[model samples]
Each structure stands twice: as structure tokens, then as C-alpha cells.
Target: MSRSKTDKPSALVATRPDPFRAAFQQTVELLIQRRADLLSETAINAYVDCDWLTWRGGSLKLTTTGENICAQLRNKARLHARA
Candidate 1:
């Protein structure tokens, strides 16, 4: 028997690990840590473009999405450390 599209896994789901996951995580960590010197202009631009971050009074600020990402990353880090 064949399954319908809804019954099967969504095509949007990734079958393999994202190669850039670690780099992206590190970038997010740097953003959360407010490590300006560690961040590239391209990375900052990408974050701004994605609405993950914003500029306020010449300083970068985290949007709600960025806050959530930081929280999730921190939680994962804590969990990994415990493991």
C-alpha cells in the first residue's frame, strides 16, 4: 500500500545532518556573548537580514527570535555538558 503525502514524512525534513550546524551554533553563541570582534560583517548582515538581530543606538540587539535561539543554544550546551 502507498502512503499519501501527508502520511509520509515532509520533504522539508532533512535526511542528513547540516554540515554548517556547528559553525552556525558558534556564531549564535558569539552573538549572544556580544563578541563583536569575533563576528564577521557578513555574519552580522545575515543575522540582521533574518530578523534575528537589530541595531539600536549603534549597538546590536537581539530580537525575540534571537533571544529564543540563544536560550535554546544555552540549554543545549548545558545538557551537553551534563552528558
Candidate 2:
């Protein structure tokens, strides 16, 4: 068997990370497990710590910081893939 320089070896390719997704999933699981109404005040407080946490909403209703944090985390993840 032979390989060419134009064909990248599988080992050389980096995988993308999805911590934000993991966090989001954990949060949702907590929401369900605790039976906390999504509208409950305590749930809101608990979820807000993620900084860029967002719920489904219109443009103005989205959590700006939460969205920003997720974007940055994803971008940083991409940077890591480049390394």
C-alpha cells in the first residue's frame, strides 16, 4: 500500500470540540431532571452562569453574552484543530 502527500493521513486530521454543546445538553438534562419549569426563576439563575447561554427567542430576546461565549468557544475549538 502507498499514500500520497496530497492525501492527508487520518492521524493528521484533528477533531473539533463541542464543549458548548456538552454544557447545553447538561443544562437541559438538569432542567428535565429537576422538573424545574423552564420559566422558573431559579432555573434562569442556574443557567445564566454559562455567560453566553441562550434560549430560543427573537433577536432582541436572545442572551447576547451567552451567544458570544458559545461563538468564542467554538472558534477557539477550531483554532485548536489547527494546532
Candidate 3:
């Protein structure tokens, strides 16, 4: 069996441990902690570009994808804390 380029995941697709994802996750964590003001413009742009966040009334709002990612991050943190 053979796989075509379209059949395989694109190299550009982000996976776990991706820097961009990590940065975005960190931003989300800060926001969840009520420290969104600490996020840089780059991080905000990355999240928006990735569709994990959207602008609402001049403020960044988490999309479903952002919420899921934040949930995953929280779970991982809890696991590490338990260990």
C-alpha cells in the first residue's frame, strides 16, 4: 500500500510539543488565570491565526478549540502535580 501527500498529514500540521502550540497553551493558561494582559501580541496573533481564538468587542475570546486545548493543559498539569 502507498500513501499520497494528501492522504498523509501535512508537515505544517502541528502536533503535541509543538512550540506554537506550547506558546498558545501558555497564553491560554495565563488567560484562564485572569492574566490575559500578560500575553504578547505575537501569541494573540498565533492563537487567532490558528482559529483557537477570536476577537469579540476588541477582546480575545477563546473558541471551542482554545477551550479544549486549555482543558488538556489543565489535565496535564493536574497529572504532573499528582505525580
Q: Which model scores highest in TM-score? A: 3
Please give the TM-score that candidate 1 achieves against the real structure: 0.56
Candidate 2 lDDT score relative to the true structure: 0.46
* lDDT (Cα, tens digit) per residue for candidate 3, span 1-45: 896654433322354355666677778668778787998887677
Candidate 3: pairs in clash: none
User: What is the C-alpha lDDT profile of model 2 across 10-57, one tens digit per residue?
Assistant: 222122236434464445545457543544555354345333334454
lDDT tens readout by residue for model 1, 1-83 = 89666443222222313433335577766756878678889877766655666889888887786676567667888999999
| Model 2 lDDT-worst window of ten | 8-17
Model 3 CA lDDT for position 5: 58
Best by the lDDT measure: 3
Span of 10 residues, lowest total lDDT, candidate 3:
7-16
TM-score winner between candidates 2 and 3:
3
